[model samples]
Target: MSYLQKGNSMIRRTTAAKGLALAAVLSLGLTACASSDDGSGDSTEGGGGSSEPLKIGTILPVTGTLAFLGPPEIAGVGLAIDDINAAGGVLGNDVTVEWGDSGDSTDLSVASSTATDLIGKGVSVAIGAASSAVSLGVVDQFAEASVMQISPANTAADLSGYGEFFARTAPPDTVQGPAHADLIMGDGHCKVGFLVQNEAYGNGLRDYIQEALEAGGCEAVYGGNGEGHEFAPGETNFGAQVTDLLAQKPDAISIVAFEETTAIVNELVSQGWDFNGTTYFVDGNLSNYGEDFDPGTLEGVQGTLPGAQADEAFRDQLTTWYSENESGELEDFSYSAESYDATVLAALAAVKGEATDGATISQNIRAVSGAEGGTEVKTFEEGVKALEAGDEIHYVGKSGIGPLNESNDPTSAFIGIYKYGADNTYTFERQIEGKIEE
Candidate 1:
């Protein structure tokens, strides 16, 4: 696809003055409103037109099965916009954002209508729809409109080449699958059982895990891809499935679903299954279940979540941002770092291409992501300075993900290993790095 040229010179002058004012305010180091609107509705006008602002739409899960992830992910986007505007905004204009709800795949209406509204708003780029299946449902709309869709938490393998306008900050299941399998086997499990959701995300990830498990001399005793044991989306009752899976008598059981994990865990408990040390969770279902389970119920359980374990400072920042902008305290920091990186990359692509249109951003996204060799920089401020100095840059953000590969998936990513404590909350234990074979 051809890139659109820059817009009117008058727009440049107006934005330049506005950018100067914003920079001046930043020099005072005071918190200020960054986006054009409050972050919900059409924040700013222009749908990738020559004289429009760089509008960003977010289709995050604010009210769905994955709502647990919405806080951190949304905070990540907000914080990135805050930082970008502080650094004089993108292309001399404050980046505007609109937030939409990406309800879980069980209900397609939420994400479908959200995508439609965002497209109608003329967003140049959209940040989420964290679920891979949800993204699959709405991605074609974004692509057809020349609007880039960047998912920070999608890991389904099939999404690698779904569209030219699509890219993800998170690595695909190919990287996460082996990493998780290695973690499980490294714990000395010879036989594993999976309680997988019957969806692309779970099924695709299950296949990779099965492959890796076999390669490691371990066995997936139950719920392998296409197995009848897999549960459908929105499945609530797990009595039969849990009993059948436990009938395999596997040493370890991995839950590869979303919010349904709660019911599954309860079923396992009801069956008197000894899961404390053998139960595992994937990103889709890994969460803080402090209120759901009794104290010590999940003790010693382990899980794997994608993205590097964010440092304390970054975590604190996300907490602060969420508190100031939204309602509650941020607890789960699952894909926050990846979400931040996705937003930063889009803004940097806008800077590199000197235009906010999706086509231009898409063309330059890979280059800014370091697919083309360049000076490595961290943070948007540093990258902007480097670009202003006529030097190419590769942005290294908090996610620690490698450059976008030819398929637009991260070439390498970090998988954080978390262990549950007595309170049913998981803590970061360590991280393993994996390179995508693609």
Candidate 2:
């Protein structure tokens, strides 16, 4: 069945001066030498005609608060590269990747420097910046350099139509937020409180969920956008925030911070607050806390994560690949499937356009995603074969997301609901499918 739903009823942050100067110089240089063809994806256009080797780059988190997401995401990229090369690579030349770090928003230097390095490397496609704030910090650099930036785990709603050069495999908060609100309301909670991180990801998601909650006749008693319960990034202390939220006498509370979730959880326990089934988590904090929290501490807690639940076959592939290549065990598999799809989609776009440059890839990305209707192929090899036979291919990747819409967000996606077990690890409960409103 097609994943699409009919009718779709559904940031530049400041950086150092050095990065800005470099990006400005690069943008001017590229514009000066740009081809007359307007990157319209026509075969006769100026940029989509090259057959050079596709060089991919990454700006994923290898350090900082969101570091837990790094393993699965990096593994996903490596696995895609392996598959692409094994299938004889793109345009008969082996694909290459330059790995870099996009540390969380706590330190802007990491993302800025890394983005500069990737853009300078002349990579055709850059694959990350997991945190929404981090991505916002460096998107202009990639956009200015005419490099396509595909993020596997950025979900801020404001990023929609940010530019022609930016795209993401993950559905925006527009899908996840309302879905999360439904989860809270479905369980009969009427008064909800949010202890959100005051950043792009947290603020945007808080707004959407709050809107849904109010629409459902539920009251957002505390932490409704700009109501002062929001915490800053790297905030290790949440005692006051918790105190403030509980004072609102809320029936449910959603914790929407990154690494700060641990501190918040601990504070909740200290306050003698009975969370269990009444507490909630979003994608940024839906982690396995078996080692962090005591047994049964989070037994009845539930959380929401974007993307469909991956099948066992794909899980095994990620597991096997990580074991053979990386050092530690793969723990949180939150965005692994999306990460794989991001890399594969970009590579497929390169193949479909018969070029490895960013402009060409951007033009063909939506087309290869089956936006115009085409044959469905699951694997990279199958997609290549189908494209070779003069067929427009729809890549049915493991993420189970529908084609990219006009905003470059997935037309439809699944938000997996998870419940914490006695071991403090979350297990899949069920998934809610949501269509992004076009």
Candidate 3:
């Protein structure tokens, strides 16, 4: 099947599953209500340790091929807000989020405009533009406005290097790709093939994985020919590409695409190609596999992603908070844990900066991450303690230890591997440590 077919198939499948909810939300603009706070009509007015409410904006794909990733990611953000508010809010003020959708276009222009609008509404800090392409487009706008933009899921390497104003909770492709490659190659695989989307995230992951494989003494059977450059989502057929890939007879194959992963898996299964011994690799996007593809096809497929929320001690507390305060269900998705952490970090930064403005918040982002002389911190209490002691702190987050290098990418941690089990379950495999090149 061609890339176009794979995308088409994905659209059809997602539409069938979510058409009603999408239509309902669109018609009523209830998508905007996803961030609605449960409060009476009374206004709580104050600022900077006053009783006023602090506003934050979130720009995520509420309606797009990547929609499944949005709710969970937002849930993380919301859970953070709930916890902070219950404990007297940020700096004694309530924090509320203004939510917007990036839509299916995922265009940077749209994202920039959205960010501009949010800044106009006086959001001190913003989280999201979940898609890297969309975030890249709007990053400059946020910088110009002096509004801090922290992405929960923007893992493109370029975003971190863009400026200090931009940061992300997720590790970039530099770490993620090598982690996947190590797992694929460490299994004694020699020949490898890659399928990548023709975007920054996809291309970067493919390049890093290829480099890692080569370093491990494995040859990439198919490289530089765009043999696997598929752009767009909801593609249904990948027969032609699969046939080409099978011809290479690689010992393993890594797919660096989002949203359309299940289609590729299903197509491979349909063609009678068993993945039993052949390693199949996926990135953070694999969290959506169960929801996007038939469970039967996904069984036994191996996926490499950031540490799972269930596997983290801090996430247990988060899960409890979410269950008690939110009406939505929570799951372990790519940016869910990180998104929550980003909000908490931003709020803590605001408190440390002694101001809730965007510029101060952005400047203090690295501080919250425990850069400089900052003490190693994680929870709100740790940060407060460090501040009280007048010490620089490093935040080892629930996501991982976030020691961003000069490039603004994380300098430590490993990608976790998991395998799909029966009944749409996932089991932990192992951690693949990644080396940073350059």
**Model 3 alpha-carbon miss at residue 24, Å:** 20
Question: Candidate 1, TM-score vs. the true structure?
Answer: 0.89
Count clashing residue pairs per candidate: 1, 1, 28
Local error of candidate 1 at 133, Å?
Answer: 0.3
Computed on alpha carbons, the lDDT of every model, listed in order, comes to 0.82, 0.83, 0.64
lDDT by residue for model 1 (1-438), tens: 111111221111112223334434443553222123222221122223233568888888887889999989988998898888888888888887767788888987677766766666667889997999999998887787778899999999989978768999999999889888988898889799999988889999999998999998898888987667888888999888888888899999888999999999899999988877798999998898988888888998998888999999999999987776674799889899999999999999888877687776777788889888798999999999988888778889999999998889998899999999999999999999999886
**Could you say which candidate leads in TM-score?**
2
Candidate 3 lDDT, 1-438, residue by residue in tens: 111121111101122224334434444442222112211212112123212345777877766667777766766776677656665666667677666565533444445445655665566678887788778777777776666778877777777678866877777887877777777766778898776667777777778788877888787886433555555554667878878778888777777666677677777777777665464656535663455545555566687876444456555655664455443555655567778778888887777766666656665667667666567775766676677577767877667745666655666656778887544456677765554454
Worst 10 residues of 2 by lDDT: 4-13
* TM-score, prediction 2: 0.90
* Stretches of model 2 off by over 4 angstroms after superposition: 1-49
The Cα RMSD of model 1 versus the native structure comes to 9.8
Worst 10 residues of 3 by lDDT: 2-11
lDDT of 2 by residue, 81-161 (tens): 878888888989887776778889999778877677666656778889799999999888788777889999999987888
Taking all chains together, each candidate's TM-score versus the true structure is: 0.89, 0.90, 0.80
Candidate 1, residue 332: Cα displacement in angstroms equals 1.2
Off by over 4 Å in 3: 1-53, 104-110, 223-228, 288-296, 308-326, 432-438
